[model samples]
Target: MQTLEKPKPKYTGKRHRLSKPELLAPAGNLEKLKFAIHYGADAVYIGGQHYGLRSNADNFSFEEMREGVEFAKKYGAKVFVATNIYAHNEDIEGIEDYLRNLEEVGISAIIVADPIIIETAKRVAPKLEVHLSTQQSTVNWQAVKFWKEEGLPRVVLGRETSLEEIAEIKKHVDIEIETFIHGAMCSSYSGRCVLSNHFTDRDSNRGGCCQSCRWKYDLFEDARPAEAWISEEEARESSVLKNFKLGVTQLPLFNEDDNAFSMSSKDLCMLESIPELIEVGIDSFKIEGRMKSIHYVATVVNVYRQAIDSYMADPENYVLKPEWIEEINKAANRPLNTGFFFNTPDHEDHIYEPEEKAVPYDFAGLVLEYDEETGTAVIQQRNYFKPGQEIEFFGPDGTFFKQTVGQIWDEDGNELDAARHPLQRIRMKVDKPVRYFDMMRKRK
Candidate 1:
């Protein structure tokens, strides 16, 4: 028999981006879920305490899961529960029960990675939508078609795919492709590396990643060791390894700089390239932080919501404000890059720095009741709202109103220095009408 080669697909640019695809964001816990809804996520994805990739983050309990779903529902935002981690046989034993409960609670979707779990979801919660998690490393049209045939309602495309590749896949496939448009990027492809597991027994897939890949190391050669790794310089200079590290120890053949393939890039940031993504036909855009605080959630969500709207409104004159970028940076973030969207994957994306020191910003309160006619807002601060500092009030329609703090009054109309307790309701005057779920923040 004669062999024949498979034809390479040509880029004819037939398919284009959706006019208005869903904006999906990650919610590690109940509060962030609220933030996601408030700031303008069309849908939010959360993980139960088990069977998710982010295990160590403050994940939701079953009770919290119910509340999270309800919270998202109130604002017309969908909630997708993640059960997307790779599982062993034992992990599958009680899977049906979990699926049943999630389905019963009206979860919008159940994201899964393992084919077994997908099967389980289909069999147990046939009514529930199944989204294929990116952990599956789905890159090509064949794999995309196979999963769609297997009954996945959507697929969270791998972070490693370039914009052009994504558009190419969209042309060939009819199924929806969800992609991580912003937020963090894994140093490795689709976050399927064992560096964290190998070094610290904390598997990232299992949700216990210690992030040893982001740790500083020294290069060693037969007892001789280089003190530190310059990731930028190394990435630009070396072809053998794009990401080089300093070896913490010296051994006969253990050269951390040369031998360590564990070097992954820093996380990805693609806020500026959103228009490019929209032009590329992405069905859904995902923000990648569940471990982050509610403030982080609110800021990123608000910025993206505005950006998406701005682009949709008038892409010809669409200009992202410098303030939006600054707002994103206020959250805990690595050095930013466009990821593999524009150029090839480079080692420069890796976080060579030590731990990120966050400039403190916390969600202080939300307007529970607002009387626009009276111009008075009744808010419940999540934390103590110390008076006298200027605070930002993020309203429902993406209008950020800043007001100088004045006399804080209790329900009795008596003034106080600060709302010094969690869930403390305080009265404040607003220049304009504030709606329910509108966020008020005090940056420390």
Candidate 2:
């Protein structure tokens, strides 16, 4: 038999090398936006006053969005505005104008879950790229293909998707694939939970999620009907007890030690799997905390930035640093887990007990301005810091050193023992020189 060589793969399109995946960060406000980019976020996603899911975030006003976009451009970073609410008829009222405004402000992209909002954007702001939000619960390659056909250039896959599934999706779909690599994990399937709406009348779909899943529950049994047990306070508060009636006794769902966090899922973390993620051809790695503190944004973004750059620079010699892991541990609010990335999470992945481990440090202050002549740093206090306390200062360069606060002065130049007020602007003498936007945190 003659051995016939397989025909060379037909080239319908030119082959191109995949570029470095973008490190996408969250920006709840302009301050967070600036720091995220400074710390090495390739792009930042933010919410506006309307139409986004983070109703509690200090979202941008139009003027602020314009300024933020301009500021992001200065660092060669992009800003994506979230208009991802599952809109009702009333919610769609001002969206057309909002889309136009976002385009005018030069937003790099718009994230949407609703078809109507996407259609409106295509009509009103044809220049903006539309990204399918994770709220749409896109799991399969077919759904991604459908979204691509609908004109979206990117799709944020649902949180429950695995690495194997993501690789499969990448093979089938040509559109950019974005997935959450770090930060809080929702208990409900891709954030579609009715508990928040049912318990608090706050629709999780339309930006008013109360996180009902994270609440502790006590199962109670009543001999009388459920209505007899409902008190005035219970009625007013929409008690969870009323939603589910039990018998004659009461049973707490968790042990005494575990009651505080019975339903709380561990936060997602993937620092150890960066190489595998890259090998799988993911287009973007998203950090999911638009409502998190600025310190959280800065620390997480900086560590991930360093990890990505270090691995890209020399993949063969790459070694995960202990310090990088330390930084992440310090920044995390809950226990960390791999989420559903490696395998489906079990009971062990959920935190049933309170987070008892103290944070390694507390965010002390932010250096607003540094005067080289006076050797003084004008600081905005985030937490209480007293003179003589040892604090570590770290910034964009990722260098940190311990320094003692020798002296502190008020805005009036009056001497002070402690910076006690929140957001108080004070001047402090530093033994080591610090730069603008440098963060000070008290060691625990």
* Highest lDDT against the true fold, candidate: 2
lDDT of 2 by residue, 351-427 (tens): 76656675567889999998899889999999999988988888875767888888899999999989999999999
Per-residue lDDT of model 1, residues 322-394, tens digit only: 8778777766456677877788766665654454665467678888898867788898878777667778887
lDDT, residue 294, model 1: 78
Stretches > 4 Å off in candidate 1 = 1-17, 222-264, 371-375
Clashes of each: 14, 2
Single out the weakest 10-residue window by summed lDDT for candidate 2: 7-16
- Give the runs in model 2 whose Cα sits over 4 Å from its true position: 1-18, 218-261, 355-360, 369-376, 410-414, 421-431
lDDT of 1: 0.77
